[model samples]
Target: MKLSLKVNGKKIEKEVDDNTLLVSFIRENLNLTGTHVGCDTSQCGSCVVHVNGKSVKSCAMFAVDANGSEVTTIEGLEKDGKLHPVQESFKKHHGLQCGYCTPGMVMSSIDLLKSHKNPTEEEIRKGLEGNICRCTGYQNIVASVKGAIGKV
Candidate 1:
């Protein structure tokens, strides 16, 4: 199958198998390994990426499904060597531990902030309910999203 995807603001055209998952395509085809595959079942947010400005589990979607759609991975957040405010906030707030879930968390947080810039604590928690971080206790992860709004 042929797929044309807009990933991280770059146009990508590739030949892929019908069974190829979006996460596999991003990590292998595009070499954007920032999006992790913690669980192929789509339960973990580790495979989260923004598709057309909305958060979706890359593992749950097919590469062909994203044809011509804009995709944003962790690598897309940085520009001109400057990290996104959410990325910086995650660092400052200690939002990660083992770091397996950081990419998805940041991606999801970016989408969340887009919808609710001034999200309350409960809203942040609710927004992140899909993404699970086994390493960090999630206190700092919540703080990171909340802290990123003003800075971004």
Candidate 2:
């Protein structure tokens, strides 16, 4: 079926199979590989992307589900060659080690911070329960989110 998508602030019209996961469409079709597919299952947040400003696991959703919706990937966070505050905080706080989960973590952190405003350490931990990262042990990751709250 033909679907129109607003991705990274641009409009794209494409044809996709009904079973095509959003992850595949973004990485294979749109070539936005930053949204990794760590787990095809919904457990991993590696495929997280913003659907109209709310983070959603792309792997858990189909490309057609995003039809006519606004989607933002990790590549969209950087504008004019400048990193977003979350990205910068991740770098500054060493939030990533293997770096596989950084995109999803960053995306989720942005949304969490947006909703929480001033989140406690525990709140940050619980807020990111959906996203799992094997590296960095989440200490620096939480710090990155805390640091990016007002800065972003």
Cα lDDT computed for each candidate against the true fold: 0.92, 0.93
Pick out the ten consecutive residues of candidate 1 with the lowest summed lDDT. Answer: 143-152
Q: Identify the leading candidate in terms of lDDT.
A: 2
Model 1 agreement with the true structure over 49-138: per-residue lDDT tens digits:
999999999999999999989999999999999999999999999899999999999999998998986999999999998898987789
RMSD of 1: 0.9
* Cα distance off (Å), candidate 2, residue 74: 0.1
Where model 2 places Cα greater than 4 Å from the true spot, the runs are: none
TM-score of each: 0.96, 0.98
- In candidate 1, clashing pairs total 0
lDDT of 2 by residue, 21-50 (tens): 999999999999999998888897988999
* CA RMSD of all predictions: 0.9, 0.7
